[model samples]
Target: MKLLKVSGILLLSSSLLFGCATMDKSTSTDKVKETKNTASEALKGVTDEYRKYAIGEIEDFVKATEAFTTAVKNGELVKAKELYGPARMYYERAEPIAEVFGDLDPKIDAREGDVPEAEWTGYHRIEKGLWMENTTKGYEQFAEQLMKDVNLLRAKVETVEVTPDILITGAVDLLNEVSTSKVTGEEDRYSHTDLYDFAANVQGAEKIYHLLNPALKKKDKELSNEIQTRFDEVYRLLNQQKNGNGYKLYTELTEAQVKELSQAVDALAEPLSQIGIVTEAS
Candidate 1:
C-alpha cells in the first residue's frame, strides 16, 4: 500500500494555511502527538526523490517569473509573451508540491459572473490573475517582449544547487496536514471531504522537509524559523475577516476594506507567486 503522510507548518485543522477561513475543529494535544507519530512512520525516505524535483521546479519557476517581471517593467510586450509560457510551465511544475491540500482553487464555480461556463482544471490562481491582466492588453506580444530577462533567469535556476533547508520547509508543511488524521474524523472542521487535499499539501511539505532537514538542522536555524514564521503569518492573514467569504460583501465592503481584501489576497498570494517574485526579483 502506498502510505500517505501530511506536511508542514500547519497548526489547527484546515486544508492549507490560506483561503476562506475553514470551519474549525477540536483536535486535542494527545491526538496531535498520535498523528505526528503515524506520519513519522508513513513518510520514511519519501523526501529524497521529491526534494530534487521540488527545488528544481521552484528555481525554474522563479526564473520564469523573473523574466515576466522584467518584460513588464521594461514595457517589452514581446518579451513578456515568451516569459509567460515558460513562467507558467514552471508554476505548473511546482504545483504538485504547493497544492497538497483540499481543492486548490475551491472558488465557487456556481453559474455566475467572471467564471466562464467551461470545465476547469486545477486552480493555480496567481497565474490566473497575471494571465488575465497580461492578455487584456498585451496578448502574446507581452511574452515576446520579455525575452532577455527570461533568458537570464532561466540560466540561473538551471545551475543553482538548492540548500536542503528549503526542502525541509516544504516537507514540514505536509507533516502538519497528515498529522491530522490521528485526530478523529468528526473533529476536523474543514470536513473529511477536503482532508485529502489538505493532506496532500501537508505530505508534499513533509517530504521536502525530511530530505532537507538533516543537512540543515545543525546549521540554519534562522532559515527554518523564517519559514515557520512565514507560515504563521500566512495563516493569520488568511484568517482575518475578508470579503471573498461567500461573496456577500460585494456591496458591503468599504473602500478601505476593499483595499484590505486586495492586500490580503496579494499576501495570501505570496507562496503562490514565488516564481513571479523570482521573475520580478533583483
Candidate 2:
C-alpha cells in the first residue's frame, strides 16, 4: 500500500481553498453569480493552460520523432530502438487533445488493425520495423509520413479550442484509453512500451483534473476528494513499475500487477467521469 505521490497536490489544495473563500460570504443570489463567474474564469484558465501544455508536448513529440526517424533512415537500428519508447511518451500525454484532429491522429498514432494495411503508417508502423522486424530497412516512407503527421498535429493544436466539456471529456477519454488499450498491452505491442504510454495518459488526464479541481471542489468536495484519492492510488501502482522516468517494458509486468493497475484505473475512471456532470450543473 505504498503511496505514489504525483506532483501538484499542494497547488490543487490551494486552488480548492481559494475557490471556497471566493464564495464563502456571499448571499444566495450573489453566490450564484460568483459561482458562475468563477466557473467561467476557471474554464478559460484551464483551456489556455491545457492548450499551452498540448502544444509543447506536440512540439516535443515532433522533435523526438524526427530524431527517431533520422536514426532509422541512417541505418542506426540500435539508436532507433533506444529512442522508440521515449519518443512515444510525448504523444501519449497529448493524445486526448491531439486526437481532436481526425485525420491527423490516425496518421500519427493509429495501430496496425486500426486502419488498412496500405494506410497503416505512423509510430506503430515504424515500431514494428524496429522491434518485430529488428531492422529499420523498408520503413523510410512510414517514418517520413509520421513526421508529416506529427508536424501537422503541432500546427493544428495552435487553432484548437478547449472548452470545459472538452477538458472533462479528454480526462475521461484518457482513462478509457488506458483501460481499453494500454492496460491490455494492445498499445505499444511491438516494443512493450505500454507502461510509458500508460503513465503519460494518466498524467495527461490528471493535468486536466488538477486544472478543474478548484471549480469541482466548489460543486462537490466529497466527489473531488474521491477522485483525487483514486488518482493517487493509480499513480502509486504505476510508480511501483517505473524505471527512472520511464517504466519497465510491458512484458516485465506480472499478471497480478497488470490486474492491479487495471483495477486502479477503473476505480479512478468512475469518479473522473462525474466531473463533467458536476461542472455543467454548476
- Per-residue lDDT tens digits for candidate 2, residues 190-269, read 99989888988999989888887887898899999999999999989988988886779999999999999999998999
lDDT of 2 at 84: 86
* Each prediction's TM-score versus the true structure: 0.28, 0.85
Task: Give the clashing residue pairs of candidate 2, or none.
Answer: none
RMSD of each: 19.7, 7.3
The lDDT for every candidate, in the order shown, is 0.37, 0.81
Candidate 1 lDDT, tens digit per residue, 1-282?
A: 112212432233333222324444444444455544544443343434564676576566556566666665566655654444334444333444434322322221111223553432212222243444543243233333333333443444444343222333344333333333312222112212222233234334433443444433444655445544554553343244332321121233355643543343333223321311111101
Error of 2 at 233 (Å): 1.4
Off by over 4 Å in 1: 1-43, 100-282
- Give the Cα-based TM-score of candidate 1 against the true structure: 0.28
